[model samples]
Target chain A: MVEKKGLSYWLSHAGLILGVIVIGFPIWLAFVASTVTQSEIVSPPMPLLPGGEFITNYKEALFSGINAPVALMLLNSTIMALGIALGKIFISLLSAFAIVYFRFPGRQLFFWMIFLTLMLPIEVRIVPSYGVVAQFGMLNSYSGLIFPLIASATATFLFRQFFLTIPNELTEAARVDGAGPVRFFFDIILPMSKTNIAALFVILFIYGWNQFLWPLLITTDPSMNTIVMGIKQMFPSGDDNANWPVIMATSLLAMVPPVLIVIFMQKFFVRGLIESEK
Target chain B: MRRTVIFKGWKLPILLLLPQLTITALFFFYPAGQAIWESLFIPDPFGLKSQFVGTGNFEFLLSDRYYRNSFRTTAVFSISVTFLSMGIALYLAVLADRLIKGAGIYSSLLIWPYAVAPAIAGVLWLFMFNTRVGVVSWYIGLLGYDWNHVLNQGEAMGLVVLASSWGRISYNFLFFLAGLQAIPKSVIEAAAIDGAKFWRRFRTIVIPLLSPITFFLLVVNIVYAFFETFGVIHTITSGGPQQATTTLVYKVFSDGFVGQDLGSSAAQSVILLFVVGLLTVIQFKFIERKVHY
Candidate 1:
């Protein structure tokens, strides 16, 4: 019933185009606001298109922000995000390897313990977790930002599931080759898990970069602020004026790294999301 | 699903498991237990000692008008966000699936918003609807609707929910699209040959096939609305206009951190823990059912 230039074809295209526009409109508006001057944005009906103040607003935001330089915040966010992603991947790989490949006491107990973490997201235990972190003198440091967040049950479980699918013959062959567990993991399992690790990295990096309440609660120091949480700090309290252009610029900057990662690494990202949830 | 061949070592395995276990105990179990513990007592104003109150904090929370209002607000906000985001995502996914070509381009464009942090989404939405300078509000004013989220409670709730749902649309869209693509073409062809129209075939066949993904998204979006919308509420309204937009998570934050009511906050956390536990159980059970299918 369908023709080359049919009503259904045109209608589907029209609907899809509308969906794309609606989805992209907010980002587009934010981009325009970032490019315009403060006065232009403060007045009603801010310019819908980009303005001449792009470099000025961005430079100001990067060099001297309301509390701390946006550059420093970006650095802090980068450090935290990378730290969490790598730390989680490293630990999850080790634990999953241990659980799957080795016979050990409390294996089931440890597995169950990790699974229990899935229910207790940081949001649920935020207050006491803050207490625990503070009691350890970790507040406002990179470790405070990174350590508590890196205990990822999801990542560990994903790796554990992957490890189970590995054929038994491979491990048997490795042992027959006089290779011990360490050598086998390094030479075989590690190399094979490269794609999964890369995929998980994409997912975890976004997770780390997007962390809000945790970073907000722990990092009281302006210099320790992540770009994501740092944007909120720029808001003017009470009657003071807000520099909308710079604040918008900061928002744009906060989105750039993760957005780029998602766009460029769409394959790995989609795989990581769907598979991890599964 | 244990592996057949295995390594025979206790030391190395323990070593490998050490870091994950230690972090989990310190961060996950310890704080969770502490939340349960602290929920049972009222701390002194000086923060030195806590008096055992049993369920006093929970009683206080249940009787508190503001706390009850927060519970209602969270219910409404999350339900709105879940339906709005999922509905739009499903529509887009259906259209994209109908296309034989260029679906990838639309999918790519739509999905990047998933990468935008929820707080940033809030800031962007706030800018667009800022009472004085927001472009959208200015247009709404042109249409003679006073659009001040600053002063209006409902508008504040709407704005935060919209912002929260904006980023989530991408996530739901991806899953729905994948679900749609996985349905067999032969099934649809068979239905069409039986004289079923597009809508009829869709209702009778496609939607049933897609139910698993839909159910999964429901739980995920609800969980997201509960916990992840904290950043949105904090940035957009600070749960403001007289706490009209405060979700339970937001209440815990404001009470525990800002109000310094640790006992009440801890009690709220315990309630939330149970809520999460219930949702997790449902999700795992549903997953087990799906595996059988």
Candidate 2:
């Protein structure tokens, strides 16, 4: 019995080790590919460790005008991401507060309408959305990119869920003390839901930074392109002999912001996922 | 007094919903409605003049060989990827849950891929799969297979599936892990005390309890596989190798953006929306009811 139990334990441990390797190998390969020169990557026996072309690859990637300059693209991505994050958080907070703290006609109907949008994938509306942005004369502009993404049904849903869990007595007390709805929400509700807000902020920031298709279709001018579009433009379609080193380098640069955000806000990120489950 | 109080209460709700409503109307509903309207009219790209054809676009799509293949490709890809990734994720989540140490490290490491955007992830995969410089190509050649995703349809589909699954597994793992943690320890302990084996305990207790999360993840994973793969497909394959990898969304983007067939693209969009909406309603109605919570 002891031997059988020991065997099962070892089997489970071995399976886990294998699983980790399977998950980790691709990421390791990505990093390795980024470091190596093009020839080393395609060599008969692929280089198992970092190669020597890191700096040269990165410099070429940064300076290449395949898209906008890499630095400018990064800057555009940052502004767009920050704008959308702030806009989404503020809008969601207000929407959640009204729904939770106030009683009004058609409230349920309005809430459901917004909730249903969460089910509507952006792909279905890409063409018409492109037309709308074009019609508004906001094409190739940051406002066009940011405005469409600012109203997030998922953020509102998350905030509403979090707000519903806050004690109503505090808001009632504020109201009795002659506090207006805005004042009550700002002073009481927002403070109580800080964790949820932080989590949503990080999530939305990542989403906005990583956005590709809509921005690609809507923004015609390379100057307004985000990091994602820049990375894509690095390797022109049907170019068999495209520079792999530069492509990898640009991809690495595009990956920087989200990786930093995730690593820095790792605590809030995990908390957000765990809390959302509840 | 009642009327005055009611009016005052409404002011807050109205203010809160105003920005969201306006944005949604302008960006989402208006565009969607326009797309639906455009689907009924064929347009000349050079002239930008549209003429109403009334179901002509839909009829053309229904009869088109390319459209039929794209529909099949999307259905097969979404279903296959969702099941494969979700199945593996559940297994990994169960394994990780049973670990006595380094659970946090395991969890965080598993989630690393999710941090990268789909476009970035596609580039990373493309870097590793390029016929000239790709490490995977080197390995494939070593194994005696002439594998170029660019030229081969089957390889292209496989690469897309592989990339999508690799990117998606982390989310499923996270959700499943959460669901596993939610199951009460005492119930598992009781089952153990009753001499129930691991498989039995999992089948009778854990599976039933985690069904809701599983179902939620299923719906989400399906939706993602259908819509979210556009970036990856566009980047890696560009719906190439004789249009073998062109899923429905890719077709929409190509037809509308590249082919400049806005009317047909809009018709396709309406069909996709209807199909997804119907599926979602059916899923919720049937599967959600079976959920314990």
Candidate 3:
């Protein structure tokens, strides 16, 4: 029995090691491809280690005059991401507080309506949504990009779930001390649910930063484009002479923010998931 | 007293709902309604002449071989991607759950793919699969299978699916890993005491308990497969190889934006909306009930 158990454990360990390799290979390849020259990448048996052309490749990618500067694109993506994150978090907190703390008429109906939007995939609405943005004269503007995505259903839902788990006694005590609804929310509720807010912040920031489709449709001008769009523009459609080293470098540049965000907030992200389940 | 209390209670919700309502109305509702209206009319490119076609666009779409092919391709794309990625993600999640060390390293590395923007990810994959310079192509040549995603429909579809799944697995893996960890250890211990084999214990106990997470992941994955693949598909394939890779959303973008057939594009959008809406409702009605939670 002991021998059989040891054998099974060894098999599971082997399976896990193989699974990790499969998952990790693409990421390793991405890093390797970023460092090597375009020619080295396509050669027979592909280079297995990092090459010395990293600086040249990066400079070529950054200075490719075909589109907006990489620095400007990164700045644009950061501004857009921060704007959307702030809007989503603020709206979500207020709404979630109202839903949880107040005994509102038709509250259930409103909640369900928002929840329904959660299931409505953006694909179904892209064409009409584009028309709406165009009609409002928001097509090329940052406001156009930020406004539509600000009131995130997922953030609101997650916040509501978090708020519900908070003890009503705390809020009641604050109310007893003559605190208004706004005061109670700002002072007590928001502070207590800081972890949840942080978690949602990270998630929404990543989503906004990585957004591509709507940004692609709305912004035709290179200056207004986000990093994701900037990356797409780097490799012009069907151009055989497109610089691979530059493409790889530009792609690696685009990856920096989200990767940093993930690494920094991972602990909170996991905690947020665990808390939401509760 | 009751009326006053009700009014007081309702004010907060009303206030909170205002921003969401405005955004949804303008961005979600109005556009959706406009698309439906536009689908019924034929409008010229300059937005000048307009004539009511009244389901003519639908008829055209229904009969068109290209639209028919897109529908077939979309089904194949969504189903295969969702199942393939979900299966792999679940397997990895379960294995990760059992391990006591290096879990964070594995999780972080696996999720790095998720951090890569879809456009960038597509570009990276495109490089790796390039005919002359691609690592995948070099290996494929070595293996004796002439493969070029740009020229072959099946190859294009495969690349899209592979890329799409690569982007998705990280997010799905997180949810599945959390779900696995949430399952009570006591139940497993009891099963072990009853002399149940590993496969039997997992099949009868863990699988059933993980249904809620599985169902949520399935719905989310389906939605992603439907909409989120557009960017990558556009970047990598542009619905190419004779429109072999064009899913419904890709078709909508092309028809409306590129082809300048606003009415047909609107019609296609409405069809997509209906399909997604139906699936969503079915998911809630049927799958939600099956969830253990």
Candidate 4:
């Protein structure tokens, strides 16, 4: 807390400025490339500023792309992200509520089962999981894309942690009001869980939006490609040229929604991150 | 973990839990159980008949050159990305901490990258460093270094690691900044009064206090590098110039999906299962301590 406003102060400012530039450089270049011609990008040292072809490039990418249109991919990504976020939150909420409020036969067993899911991320178990989904004929479908990915340990864990912190007195008070468990949950717990839900929503939305490998493996159909996975497909195979401007545009489009969420709902996102960790 | 609450039910609670349980059984438990079951059997690539070879896949993986190299490569990549990202993040965080004003701005600028997917990050980095047309590669060439990740193994590894670290820097930075800001200024002021310089005060007081977060981040970052960087490696190199960038997770996909080596891939998955389990336990315990410490 020493307020020495001489060399050290300026140095710190300079350091952060430098850090910001270094961190932002790649994205900035990508943005510039997105707005430029392929010739500009393919030639050495593409112009470092935004070009006149911004509308043309993005229009080309979103309307008609290499394999599937970027527009379709964006929609796919939206559906998948929203589905995963809402689905995970929905199941986790009910499960957490059930585990926390009820003392029933096999309650502990069920809770442990949900807890067990926390460790086996899809990356670890993708092959068999893919097979299981395929057996159910869910591959390339939204159900296959979303359902297999929705069993989140942390979301339920966060909700469980949250439910534990709610006073038992609330339940007792609801009981005194002649309310049943379901009635009490709908009337009280869900309302009180607004902040936690919002926070978790922010984090889960980002997590869902950013999933790449699962979508890549599951959606063999080009029409079903999520924007995140679809970007990888934009690269032409073998010696054929990569459409850099379109790819860059698609990349930017893919990042926009999630990045906007993080920026706008930063407070909730941070709270969600910290609380979920706990 | 128990709640001293009032609700007592077998039917409604069970009903409420059924959906989650069903999904878990169908998706998580069944698949995981199947992975373990399949790991013991070597099914032919044609998916017709299978022979039971208990622990054969594990033994083969341990002895197999590609698998061993993947494990080693994964270790090297994990350590590099974890340290490189965390180190730069800590530096930026410290610098931001020094500023009484504009720290929030720096934070806001830095943290948005947390939203960027690892695959997209890889593309951005690859675009910049792609030998023929890459801007950075051109600049580096001007500096007399031929930066071709296509043919160069080390360069390929470095690109994926950099791409992975770039997106991760934001997450680590957020935690580090939070951790840095949490340290009491009174302690630092006292150190300064005792004639301790900035670096000395930071070395003695700040670092010791920040160790809990650093340790927590270490575990999180390693888990990230091990599993989550699949996208980064996939996009940039596709486990590249002679499998140079193929970490453990990438190898799982490459062998299982690409090569269709079901038994061997299942074995690798089982091994990753243990790694994740161990990390989760450590993370859970450390999280408890984090709450305490």
Candidate 5:
């Protein structure tokens, strides 16, 4: 409506449509590859449309993949995703509640310490972080997979930002009503943070699910692999023919949960992403 | 950062912060400190002892031809990936902003790629460019080119860049769309009344207004390509046919994990630390400015 009856509008729509198709074509082709037979995929120029082997390919991949079964990896991925999301949210909420509602010695110190973690992503500190985890005898455990990734400054920062926007009167009224700090937090802050918590849950869940290097390093056992990392394991060892159909099937499976979250919870995800950056 | 209306218990506040602080100390600070300390020590082959090296590892890496090339490789890789992804996303966002309906539909269709892990994104693109079986590779072959990323360093770098950029498009699109929608309709309408055509208005008014977001994204994307693309590089190039695709992050992983050169890897990690610290500061500076808006 900004410009009425213009060819530009049609062109805009056409460009967007083309963008969508281009954005989507790779995955669509991957999905098509997943449904086809391996022979068809290996032969070159695989069919663009769906094939008849979808069920068998998915079945084989899920039941028994190249190294470990996809089903097991899926379970590991679920645990990691849930563990990171809930763990980050719970701890972040507590930290934010303390920083916002309590005045104590070393509060600023603690805040800066947390802020420091924001710059230190796992990629930069992989060697030493791996050493720390290994020294703790935590390698190959679920805690190893989850705990190191849980100290997310962004989540704490986002929670702190959200809590800062809460009205002072709410805290004052809670104190006036003879509520201790704990009670006030339980009855007031927790309930108020429901939407924020949900938004963060969606974002953190995806972040956790999509982690690659940490899980690859920590989980030496193939059975312990998260599906995201496990997909790489499914590739052929050498120049041999990769089980493209099965690998493609696992790729789609590795993506489905997080993609569903982003698509279905688009509003929360968008809000969380923007707010977290702020 | 402190709230004026606050609870008064030091014990409870300390208790509340304990978990985060503990994990930070154990996983974050301690590791980071170890990285710095370990950068000064080179271990023996038998793992018996680490000899103290005062900046020897850094000197070695700085002089090494491959290490120097990795810096160049990373520079080109990150710049290409950041600009290509942002450019496409901005184009799509502008188009989406113009449409009154189906914007949501188009966004949903387009953005699911964001949730796909970088490794998975690599796999998807690798399959399409797999010389033996790839449909795209076959198409390129028909165009009189032998498209093989396996033996070709340039093709390998381009493939990883494409994979990394492809997944990032949705992220940039979402932000760009938000930024586009945030632009005041009144300013654009005023420009239209001034007889500025669509491209001119977009070029001048919309882009300048979008600069904050663009700057923020540039820093973010550089950080992303610097660190977050380990998976893409790992799955696809594995630092290459001739180490042509080895970014610093990939080099750190391969050297530390594969080569088990803790001293050099720790040295690289420390370098990456400064890079991230710089990016974090730039990002925060922009966020501060954005708050003023």
Candidate 6:
């Protein structure tokens, strides 16, 4: 490729810089608002820079929010995110292992059943699904928050795709070494699947952390509210009295963990995203 | 794609598969079947006795003015978000692809937005455009336009669309950049050697090669806008200002949860089931073609 150092190179840099600024401007404003007073944000043309009330606002949000304490919401979000990620990965790994390695009766039927889960997202079946959850007495429980959302087959399919790529010789070699299927899975397969597992974990963590509608429906209690849904609850019913600073602070707190995961585990995040979608 | 070497015991596999299957049966299939069953009948106002009116709910939904308008709104919203997000992402990707250095920084900056939840994205945008203290709305007001999404239908739609597309740009950008990078440099250089300018080379060579990814993104984005934007619409507009922004998913939640119209909501859910099935089939079909490319 020819190297161009003149106008075009500068033009590309300029364009990308502008794009970054436009993309990042909203979060920057949110940060500034989080640091300022409610009056500053409520009055026209809020200040663009950070203010002195950063600690004050975040403290208020964390200790005692309008509907529920932001601290509790954050904790709820953490538990839900970790539960969904770990639970989905565990089940998907087991199911993918079973489907890929076994040739039992009804295998294909089970595989298709799992695959069909992809077509029916919770949004489509909100009413009946809610009723089912209520029937099981899972409402307001973490199980309610996590289990319904985990039935999807994205992770299962991802693991299945990965397990297919493993050579058959590995399985044969393990059998020759007098290892049972369970032993072989524990000794060889799980160790080999570390990268895929990590990658999927990254993507699944974000997916779980960012979930909104499901959590919104099941958790009627303020204490059970995830930060993402809890933010909306902070808004006054009639309007014009939104607690901007604390809401903004809580918003930033809501974004921090998932955003940090994406930044730090970026390579895995990208690989997992592309692979899962494929 | 099954492995040749296999596990022998049916019992072990069944045992392993039980958790997922149980969850799927209990959560996915049962609720889905219930939705279909409930869709066929109209429950009277009292919860005690329900008369079975086969397909009455579906019939009413298909004819209801608001339901039809919601379908249209969903179509318009999905198309707008898909195109808007994809177009901006493609533009940024092209620029990033042209850069010989520092692409990683721009990518790292841009990609984090994907982690922001759609609900949070809505809140952030709503803050910026809030009529009273929203900086952008204030600026618009200074420009002599009353930027009120509360009363204005078009502005409400525009705001929600923008909020929905904002976070999605990062996902599309990452894919587009990967697609751009996957294009062999030799092909582009060869086109360049044939006296093609940048725009011409991009048009004749780059765009064609990028079609598979573009198509994949299109399907995924439409699915996203259809189902996932519920959070965005919920937070920002709540399908507000006279139902101008009420999408199909929003309508399902509003009708079922808020209005307690179980029969009608079940019918809407059944309808969405077919819509999603159709989209998934289209995606699989395109992916089959994509393999040959």
Tens digit per residue, CA lDDT, model 6, A152-221? 9999998998888888788778888888888988988899999999999999999899999999999999
Question: RMSDs, each prediction?
Answer: 1.3, 3.2, 3.3, 1.3, 1.3, 1.1
| Residue B52 Cα positional deviation in candidate 6, in Å, after optimal superposition | 0.6
Q: At residue A168, give the lDDT of candidate 5.
A: 75
- Interface RMSD score of candidate 1: 1.5
Candidate 5 regions off by >4 Å? B1-4
| C-alpha RMSD between model 3 and the true structure | 3.3
Greater TM-score among 3 and 4 belongs to: 4
Top candidate when judged by lDDT against the true structure: 6
Q: Write the per-residue lDDT of candidate 2 for residues B3-75, one digit (tens) a residue.
A: 1111156876898789888888888878878988999998876746889999999999999999999988998
**Taking chain A of candidate 6, what TM-score results?**
0.98
DockQ of 6: 0.84
Q: What TM-score would you give candidate 2 relative to the actual structure?
A: 0.92
lDDT of each: 0.92, 0.79, 0.77, 0.91, 0.91, 0.93
Q: Candidate 1 residues A131-180, lDDT tens each?
A: 99999999999999999998659999899888888887877788789898
Candidate number that wins on lDDT, 2 or 5? 5
lDDT of 2 by residue, A71-173 (tens): 7888889999998988988888888777766688989988887876765678778888888888999998989999888754878877876766665566567
Candidate 6 regions exceeding 4 Å error are: none
lDDT of 4 by residue, B173-243 (tens): 99999999999988888889999998899899989999998998999999999988899999999997898
Q: Backbone clashes in each candidate structure, one number apiece? A: 0, 0, 1, 0, 0, 0
Q: Of 2 and 3, which scores higher on TM-score?
A: 2
Evaluated at residue A34, the lDDT of candidate 1 is 89
Question: Cα lDDT for residue A231, model 4?
Answer: 96
Tens-place lDDT digits, model 5, residues B94-205: 9999987878888888888989999999999999998899999999999999998999999999999999999999999999998999999989999899999889998999
For lDDT, candidate 2 versus 3, the one ahead is 2
Measured against the true structure, the TM-scores of the candidates, in listed sequence, are 0.98, 0.92, 0.91, 0.98, 0.98, 0.99
